[model samples]
Target: MPYFSRLQERPKIISKLYSNVITFLTYIVTPVLLFVILFAEEIVIVLFDTSYSNIAVLIQILSVLGLLKSFSNIGGNVLIALGKFKVGFYWNLIWSLVLTLTLLVSLQYNINLTEFTLVVFFANFASFFVWHGIILKYINIPYINLTLRFSLVFVLSFLFVYLLKSFIMFWPSQWPQSIMLGTYFSLLVLVTAYFTLLLLKNQKTIIFTLWK
Candidate 1:
């Protein structure tokens, strides 16, 4: 947000911007992540081919990067907005170097997808926290609330998506016959359930204009 540009000049507004960012991450990205995690195998089956099912586990691990990189993305913007652009630049440079080194080292060994993904996840997650630490000196992030709320919503969203996936997998002959049908029904259930939960929590704030 452009408002972040003046954060140093107007420190008090930082909290409002941080709050909105957290809400956007919590309400929106978390659901997508939940979908990726719960249905990674089926999603993998559909997206590429059934042969790539092995990568679904990799995708599940990589899905955590959604939340991590969300913070990193916002932190990059904060650094640029605060006129500390080089910090963001150099930090990313280091991450790239580490990734390259990891890949090079792995080439010599027989690293599985899960093990490789774990390495990358730590690299990205550590960089995310480092970037956020630099930004926290300027921005007033609700660390505890953001963590607790996001974690709670993540579990709830995962359970919701898991239930839908389970029904699609184990239900009777009503199971969708084609991928197109299955996708449509999955989206229908997902969007409806997610918005319903949001509405039950905060109808006035979250569910407004959802139809529009």
Candidate 2:
């Protein structure tokens, strides 16, 4: 049987599992491995030379690009699982073209690395709107409604993180790296706790565990 037919037959089971596994492996594992391989040398240099700014710049650039590519793949995979393969293919193609053009233009104009990074991030985020429309076409889902609910929780979490960071910044600078790392993790915990409480209060369907 063709792939689309299989999806149509058992969408809730097959599609969900396929989408979840592929998303985890592609968005998580592949990117980590790629970063390790691509920047091994730069990472070592940064460890030895703490003042190395290139590594930070490289990280900023890669982080945005990685997010863009990962989300593009995710949107495509979701469309495929919903048995809208053509929409998946076309949108992915369009996103790829947009990224390529943006990259070329950035290079041509000699744009500052920070500005280039921001441009790429915005471009990637812009595609999500289009992807949401495509997802709704077949699923009849209100992407905006879902996004708003999640965004509320996300904003609250970010606020917690910001507050924690601000508090830490006021601390004495003589703190050990171990102490700094602990502080960072503590902030993460606090933000996560805040978000968890908000989610429970809102009683939103927890799709993250299902996908995980």
Candidate 3:
């Protein structure tokens, strides 16, 4: 309501609000994305057993797609909100063409499942930048701020996970009955800490309003 209410009289306000929301969401989700990517093997093993072990790689790869889609979806909504429906259509068309053409080219080489997935992932990644570039023309988003926050979150999450992994690997085998149990406990703690800090930092802001 706030965004639409001010759409005509104060689009600058809407743009700022939308940019902040996107940045906040990126911070929140990037950690989870990193967690999933880093532990894809363990996750697959725990959830589906070793029978479908090969799917772990796919999960890790597609995890990136999830992040890209989040940004692209938000960008699409921004275009629509601004009544730039034609721009949104062009963005989608470009994405489709990128994915289809890349897949077709890869097929010529008789690519396997993993290779095929990579082609699709790369195509989305390529188109993501294009979509966001179009979005910038319509919305006064702080692209640098978004990039910096995303980089910071990504680095912090990666370091936390890496340290957790390192500690687990170095601990005496006799200390823990199961390494997997230890990993899960440590990850839970770290994830909790991450979110706790994030919430505390943004507590004064109307960050959650982005969802509504």
Candidate 4:
């Protein structure tokens, strides 16, 4: 973003820019991840086989981690651009330690895939806030505002996905042959439409940001 070059001269504008970027990214990312979570079973079955369907729940858990990592990736770049390398380093260090220790403990207990992924998710989630705190010191990110935006996206996507899933459940099972396969494509199209509508609504801002 051009705003990256002007951070020192205009902190307030940069803060607003950060807010916009975060909001844009949240909208772009949350629905995709939620879709994966909701349709993981069908996704696994299609891509692999029914035997691999057992790992669908594990994929759902990891999708949450993927969301956190995406946010962290942006924050890391911002921190490096702002010359806060040490802060990023410590955040990563803590994250690594927690993840390693958890994995070690889980290994000893012979943890199942879902439980093991939950441990990994919690570790990453713990560090996610720490990274945000570091960014707040440098950029004044609107935490409350971002939280509300994220919650809205999550809730809306969940409702949208579930309602569609419920609707598809009533369809004749033999028509599609595999009910999950039908549900998968239906949800995929619905999510694509939802994302397209969001893009249209924000097209002006997106164009301005891109051209700037």
- For 104-165, candidate 2 gives per-residue lDDT tens digits of 88888888877787777788778766776676566544345444644554455445445544
Q: Candidate 2: lDDT over CA atoms?
A: 0.54
- Candidate 3 residue-wise lDDT, 46-103, digit = tens: 7767788789999999998998787667666566667787988876787688778778
1 versus 2: better TM-score goes to: 1
Per-prediction CA RMSD (Å)? 4.4, 7.2, 3.4, 3.1
**Tens-digit lDDT track of model 1 for 164-194:** 7777767734543356436744784577567
Candidate 2 segments exceeding 4 Å error = 1-50, 53-73, 190-212
Better of 2 and 4 by TM-score: 4
- Which of 2 and 4 is the better model by lDDT? 4
Regions of model 1 farther than 4 Å from truth: 177-212
Residues 1-212 of candidate 4: C-alpha lDDT, one tens digit per residue: 43465465666656665666677777777877887888788778778889999999899989989988877677765666576778878877887887788899888998887888888888778778877887888877778977997898889878877765666567635553256555565766676667756764765443355566
For model 3, what is the C-alpha lDDT against the true structure? 0.72
Off-target runs (Cα >4 Å) in candidate 4 are: 1-6, 173-207
Q: Judged by lDDT relative to the true structure, which candidate is superior, 3 or 4?
A: 4
lDDT per prediction?
0.70, 0.54, 0.72, 0.74
Whichever of 1 and 2 has more lDDT, that candidate is: 1
- Each candidate's number of clashing pairs is 0, 0, 0, 0
